[model samples]
Target chain A: MTLLSRRHILAAIGAGVAAPSLVRAQSSETLKIGGMLPFSGPASIEGRQIVQGLQFAVAEWNEKGGVLGRKIELVLEDDESNSTKGVTAVRRLIEREKVPFIIGTYASAVAIAASKVAAEYKVPMLSGGSTGAGATDQNTAGDPWFFRSWPDSNAQGDDTAKAIVNKFKKTKVAIIHDNTNYGVTLAEQVTRVVTGVGGQIVSKDGYNAGEQDFSSMLTRLRGLKPDAVYIGGWAGDGANILRQAAEIGLKAQFVGSGSMLSDDFIKLAGSASEGFAVATMFEASTPNPIGKAFAERWRKSHDFDANTFSALGYDSTNIAIEALRRAGKPDGLEVQKMLKDGMKDFPLVQGPAGTTAAFNEKGGVIFPNFIAVIKDGKRRLDV
Target chain B: MDLFLQYVANGVVTGSTYVLVAVGLTLIFGILGVVNFAHGEFYMIGGYVGIVAITMLKLPVLAAIAVVLLAAALVGLVAEAILHKPLKSRDATNSIISSFGLAVALQNAALLVMGPQPQRLNLDVSKIPVLSSLPTDFGPVFLPQQRTLIPLTMVILIGVLYAVLKYTWTGRSLRAMAQHATVARLCGVRVQSVAVVTFMVGSALAGIAGMLMSSIFFVYPVVGNMIALKAFTVVILGGMGNVAGAAVAGLLLGITESLTSAYVANSMRDVVGFVFVILVLLFRPQGLFGKAAERS
Candidate 1:
């Protein structure tokens, strides 16, 4: 083997150093949008669906010659459904990837955590999956870069409590929520609304996520003799609760947030899910032309039918694209301003027949919530 | 009074599953002296096995249970031979770390195979003739036919285990090994074979528990995480390596959690176990049922 000279070694080192920057320069022609999602953790399944929606919207936009005359590119980072990891992922997107805007996050805690970093970097971060109200609560005057396309948990909870009180005419309500940020925030909203309407909350309790046995809790709720029970948790636990409640002969109207509006809930709860009402923003049976097209496209690609999270992901990506088009540049502050002021009566894949989506002053989405009930193993709109 | 009885019934049923898992863990620790952090993964595997046996193979409930047990035993044998046996002479921490790695690997394997969706093991009690004939509603306590199966299975399995441990030659050898491994081996106990048997039995117990609970809770990849934590708690509360203590502690912890959820805040139900464990550790380090370490 021939020994390398100092000049040859120096040339090799220089090439290695220049390689990454050269690649970056070439890729700079494409407008890069960051996606922070839980692609490999507990919420990975939901993250997969959201990514699909993001990719679908990006593909559609690219087909139409991309945004700002630049080919749109998506830079993805896995947050692992964790708060700390979410912050790290968002920082990488803003600092390393240098994307002007981001779309993501399934978990509320992750969304809330990552949005702080996005706000610090002055990058517009659009959340499509997280429903917790705390994410938008961080959009202050000093750092107003977070926007949520999906309706918050408070909206769903408010509508659910109204349905239980005014529609179902249930005075004594018991609330069982998972002890997570999303569940707790939603439960608090329901409690506030129910008590505000002269309704008595007999028993309000929280259970850990993945808890299967709700026997004692249901038995205790039975003793309270409440007219309705509001469940604020994931679909798995909610299904188990419904089944256990029926087994213990706890006869009360069961209501839940958008988390319950899934086939898993109806399938797992079986006959117990009959008449179980949930307040949701997105339904597969949405009558809107855009929603119908999205659902059809989703079904054509994926084996299963489109759900709320996917619709949220698709809508949020489209919202970001629309803002970018209106802003006429890939500037973060301009994109944020467009999202805040320009998106008035924006059409969404979610909401009612004639309902439109808009961003309120707090960066939260203003959309109509619908109450649906499980009827003969199918979720049908009740109100 | 009826409400109290109902809560108690609920506690007992929930406790039965805990006993099954914790007893297996205790037995493995007692005999092999190997802290199997992967014990919960066996339970998860059992649920998946049960689902496959029933859904894909179209087996009856009894046949599906047998399939789960056999599959779990095979997996236990492989795990013992490869993961445990090779590192047997090394530091105990080595085995523990290996088992922890095994747990992660097994969990991810299950996730890859089953996907992330939670699957229900639809064992219809109405279809079972004997179960259908039994009265479900007893005064104030309403125990569903499916739930009643849990305690019944727990009693039968524990009884079989107790009988085997008390009367059989293998049982005597196992007890001897638990008492003193070196002395037992010197007395021609065939330590290696006995260790394998102990691991298999323990894994089978955990697997069966998973199968039973899956019918009620539904089965997911990470389904065993919470139950395994509860089992470890039971193992500690009852005194590690003490089978009888595990049984008692499992039932006691279950009742305590149920009562706490009913009387106290439901949110504090899981916290009760850790708190009790801390109290036990501070007050009685030898555990409630565990005797003081005796010199041979």
Candidate 2:
């Protein structure tokens, strides 16, 4: 140690303290992205898995020296699967946190509600799980910053209708859906597609989510004697409806949306779940290089099996990062423009569903559709 | 006519479930003079307990039900100690507020532990003799073995509870406390003990309902929230503190729901149920079978 004057020592201390921040300030520091997740409600199971995938992606990116020399930071807000709460969460992310990007909302209604706020503030929002048709409709009065990682219900409904008519060879079908934006809209689309294909819809019904008693509904449907029953809802409600239908001895062949193709659905429906078919995006049994690696890493880290939601979440994060890279800066407008211009053909990783994860003009993902059935108490890809 | 019978049968089955949940709530309210708003959470807890018993422990159906009853009773006992006993007043509003908080806490605890996914009990009774042997007429009057079991079990349990309340020493004490808590305490009745028994019995009833329905409706954290509202409606329709009335009204409400769903639109089912409640309140505020307001 050399003795020095007070001014000399002060100058040396200032230099040491200022050097790191100067480098950080020049390199753009850390970029924060907001996440509005349902971490504490009925959809928490899916939300937790989704966040796991997002965190995994962020960690991997940081390990390779983060995008634009700045580590990505995620600011999470719990939407609780409620539309009002989801709006508040998005507002906080935009107004207070000032995050340029947001990904979230397991429920479609919540996503639609939050997107309004995102539109008002001019921030880009990518929904990881919401599949409601309203999430991306250009007709909606909003700034076109809303995009989704999964295909909308209209696409699924059209595919499901095709499967029911062409493959199952069913002409008379009854329909029931959960009374939510996702379920109701999907049912509407399915009805449209079925009628368009000349299939007669004999009966239409709706029930609240979390309702377990479908004895009366089944009894009424049983009287009609339709050739098949189409359920537009998530797995939990679908399983309940299927089990009750079995208990009531309603023998209509059952078909559900892609949301029903999960291990949980199989476990809940049990033997009643046998013969039920679903048209879904992701099938865990499907062999894909990217999906296998993601699953392996997920299982090793989380000590649990990853579902389709997790895979989509991982893919969505990658898409956002790519857009960030293409933008070449942290400005929200630049990033949104870049994504709108080229995200449709961007070469993203192959999803677990074994489809190239590409977006259409409406921010809807374009992927191959596969039909699955619960056979021998497992979700097996049928066609 | 066969379809009519089927609707009736369906109503009875649905009503039996309502009776199990409503009677317990009325009994607790009558004795404790505190509306246990967390009653639904107890029902939810019962479902979870039943799942654990049947799936994890691999217990038989009856044994699983027993475990659920015991566990839910214990939870109710602890809840009474922590939440109810501390309240300075027995006002309905006070109890409602405290129990509502308890309800939120319990639901959140369940979500944290169970991960918000619904789990099934996986108990099927397709081959039971008595249930299978039941006479059925085509599509309408058909009653599965498991569906028949709901009303049968409800009748048996209600009979037992009635006999116990009518004959047992503890039953007399509970009735006496319900009539006049201060007078009973002054007359040497152990108020604390009666309160404990009330919660236990009420919680056990909720547990039994959850266990029985777990096979059909499945088990989840929010499973009881909606059913609890319907049960409350039944309690009010049958007279706020009348157990026998809850049983009768529950069956009536269930039938109404079934008929409404069949003849009217499905969405009109709950609306009709509430309409019945409104009409009952307008005409007979004491409920269909309840006694007129009395002065001590």
Candidate 3:
């Protein structure tokens, strides 16, 4: 209760004034964005492409002045496509890094898990290549914080059907999938879309992941003499399908989901994969400056060519930064609201010219897609 | 009928590879009386070596393969010196725990060195022709250059192993030690050397499988667990201590799994395979070809 000296009080007041600016400077200068993707485990090959794309986006944005005049820092954690590990990783990003935005959780299951944490914090989260529809389907009321740059599974399947009916001109098609949520959903979508358009499914088969030989399925397919075969899978399973099909004497035209659009696929299937076609979220030669830029940057950085997710990653980050700019701050709630409004329209260097992310009352990116065929062991426009 | 034939074709391709891995596994276990838990790691290591040789170093596929096998042999030698020799005549629990630790270490090391991404490799030779007589409707079954080499390699490997075990003094000593350790040691057979050789053979096989698989399946760090599980299954199915049984059981298991995948829902095929294994265990614990003494 004794009276403090006037000089002591002034000194304490000066310290308080000095600390506030320091805190504000630290907070306003850096915006931390967490990235969770399968950098290892089964999907790591594709996951690496995803990570590279994300990096390219961040690099481009930082070069142009980061979100809201602050440097955007990306902190990546490997989920390995394990749902449990995904949740743990997102939790670490949220609680430890205090990231207001997250760019990934590539597999649908991992995305579902990570989005739970994102929903809890009202933070904005987006994915490049998870097409299970489960990633974006649950929010009938429209998820405020969850947005995706890639088309939904239903869209992909419909696109595949379009290719089959309009392009392939085939009356009967066979669908073989890995039976995961992505595979089965896409297969079902394609089946419905194809049959709806007067095309019949000659055969359908589902296989397990890590499956080595698809000869049995291929054998059945060969006997059906179907005009075409659609495979929906990736990694070890996807590669082996082509390998086994070649061994089993299957001559039908092969089509696959986005999962087939990997460099590893062509390598594993060898020359047998030359005539395959796939529907993917992106094509390296998207005829867009943004797509070209991302592709050029990526090739310079790694030996692998650009895949669909790489372009999506670039677009997703571009949208995130746009929202950040509109919000004028990296606050999760402010950025979430801005993103939901879909304010900016910067054409990213990915696929066909597209505006900034526009949500159709649902938290999904209404981005255009491409159907590329593997000709001569490379992905080229089917046309 | 065509579909069935196709499935059989698929099974044949996969079963052939299983035969190769299983045979190598059984040979080591038969002679050493020790389970090399790190066999799968050796395979993974071989894959990495091949990738580095071919992709980064730009070596021819065959040279890369040779380099991988050579590296694998060296790794096997190291395993023999450290794991097998040290554990010889020691407690089973100690060796099991130690070798398990070694396997885990090797897996992590692989992740560290290779950066945890799957890499691709192709066969040096062009595609093989498994059978040329099938009709055009049979489609174009790949006789992947690797598939043709598998059987030829298996024969060469078996013959070499047999020659080493049967004709050479080293081969005779290994058999003598395996059949009766005390008497073989007393009769001037080098028990320690034979055990070391067994470790070497087992590891080298795993490595060869790993390298060869890169041609058929993509290779990555997680592959160790996969190869380990399948190889272990093959060993148990054929009788853990029966070399010839392992070779046959592996092919049988591979074929059955392929057939299951084709006929059943893809996911359920794994369940069916496990179920079959359980049924087999319940009925004949010694496996299909396992003998009385070889039964584990």
Per-candidate DockQ values are 0.40, 0.36, 0.34
| Candidate 2, superposed: residue stretches over 4 Å from native | A1-30, A95-98, A138-143, A285-307, A348-361, B88-90, B124-141, B294-296
Candidate 2: residue A41 Cα off by (Å): 2.5
Judged by DockQ cut-offs, the docking class of candidate 3 is acceptable
Q: Model 1 chain A, poorest ten-residue lDDT window?
A: A1-10
Q: Which is better, 1 or 3, measured by lDDT?
A: 1
* Candidate 3: tens digits of C-alpha lDDT, residues A91-170: 88888999878888778888887887778977778774576677777654544566876568777778878788778887
TM-score for each model: 0.91, 0.88, 0.85
Off by over 4 Å in 1: A1-31, A40-42, A69-71, A287-293, A296-304, A353-357, B127-129
lDDT of 2 by residue, B88-141 (tens): 265568878888877777776776667578887666564444555775444547
lDDT of 2 by residue, A41-122 (tens): 5676667567766767776776676788877766677777888888988988888877877887778778888887887777
- Return whichever of 1 and 2 wins on lDDT: 1
Each prediction's whole-model lDDT (CA) = 0.82, 0.77, 0.71
lDDT of 1 by residue, B1-296 (tens): 88898888889988999999999989988888888888888889998998899888889888898999999988888778856689889988998899887887787677667866678787777777677788888897888888888888899999999999999999999999998899999999998999889889988998998888888888887777788889989998899899889999999999999999999988899999999889989998778998978676
Position B79, candidate 1: lDDT: 75
By TM-score, rank the candidates, best first.
1, 2, 3
lDDT of 3 by residue, B1-296 (tens): 54555556556656666666666667667767667777778888888888888778988765676887788888888877767777867977766677687787777667656755456675545323333232334354445455555555666776677677679888788778777788998999877777767766776777777777776676776577766777778887888667677777776777787777667655565566567668768988877777655435
